[model samples]
Target: MSGHSRLVELVPLYALDALDPSEAASLESHLEDCEACRAELDVHRNVAAQLVPDEPPAIHVWDRIEAAISQGDEGEVIDFGAERARRRGNPFNWMLATAAVVALVFAGVLVGQRLAFDGLSTDEGVVAAAESAAEEPGALVGDFLVDDVAVARVVLSKDGLGYVIPTDALDTLDPSRTYQLWVLTPDEVAISAGVLGADPGPATFTWKGDIAGFALTREVAGGVVSSAGDVVSVILDT
Candidate 1:
């Protein structure tokens, strides 16, 4: 039989230094030319290293391991792979596997939290702007919709300050274009609030005077003084 067929279980045992000297010597010889076994050995070795603590576990730990092995079967073959797959699983290895899975899950949660809150300061500003505008005495709060789909919320304070809170809809903007917010008056006049990046999150603008509502238009980067492109979305105060 080829090396892997014979040494599949032995490789993992050898990685843990649990194999006898003779068995280890034999496995080391096979490892010299068997790339597949070497890779598998490395994987098992890494997992074992990560699970083992720097400080030795209590004496009861050895007792539990002994009891687990004895319960598995004193006369059974010492094949780690077969033992893992056996009908009556070894509790010791199962505990180790569970611990490894928990460690991996905890690590993944930490990474996800880091990515989710990396822009905490910016998000704080968005929430603060929205709350502040909402609390203003005569703030006009309205939603900007496209094709009957709400994409952004516009808040206009009585002091002529405006804030735009973008939604998931802005994700569809073309990378080559910028979105510009305009304050439209009753006589059909549009005033530019400011030009925004393609996928802006939240923005604040100043409109000294306003009459009707707001409109969003797509324009080239470094937005024009006046919009000449098709309007993407509109919000009417009425």
Candidate 2:
């Protein structure tokens, strides 16, 4: 396979913050010249953002996010409740949703094994991350993948806080486009979770309502009234 093809497979995981140091370093170097991969990487990173476990701030997160974008901050959180509430609810067709869910579950199992193999308690960061997760009730965790390869993991708390833990697989995107996350409500209406980028690790955001699942799409840089890009991934809020 060509280098781009290989890197394409790794973009999702890289976005999830699941890539090891050496592998991640190599990918970052490749990204400097490969703008297509960089854009694809942004897609995966934004999709994976939904799986992170951190909590969003109380208010004006979007204000800060816009400021950060203007100031060239690496990453920033943005609110999506209002936009989500206003959008018409046409979620992905059932078959596609089911397929994505299956892939996500399969990837989650593999990622769990990888985490275990890495030695659990020895990594203080892992332990702390777990302890942090333990504080939330009805917390949901699962893997998201592209073609059965583990790319990212999603976590949501009973209170609606969320996090996306991505691995070493992801894809880059176009500079004129941005990735947007959507939360499907129990009523079947999809709500926006805000835009996403390539600055891996964890980001925090808030949503209101009974969430049924999540979706990702690429839209114009700032975002749009409705998602125009193809649905890339879906994970029903479980």
State TM-scores per candidate: 0.47, 0.50
lDDT (tens digit, per residue) of candidate 1 on 1-238: 7666887769889778799967776776677668888888889979998997799779998996787568444533222234333654642233233321110011222322221212222456765766566555676666666655556667676787777877765543433468988766655555567777777777888776645667777787766544443567666545
- The sequence of per-residue lDDT tens digits that candidate 2 reaches over residues 1-238 is 9887887778888877788977876777688788887888888878877777888775788895676466444432223334443463333444234446632232333332333212122334543453355344465555555687655556665666676554556455434456666666666555567676643343445765566677766577776545553666777655
lDDT of 2 at 174: 38
RMSD after CA superposition, every candidate: 28.7, 13.1
Q: Candidate 2 — worst ten consecutive residues by lDDT sum?
A: 112-121
Q: Which portions of model 2 miss their true places by more than 4 Å? A: 1-31, 34-99, 103-131, 198-201
- Candidate 1: lDDT of 127? 53
Q: Pick the candidate with the highest TM-score.
A: 2
- Steric clash pairs (candidate 1): none
Worst lDDT run of 10 residues, candidate 1, spans 99-108
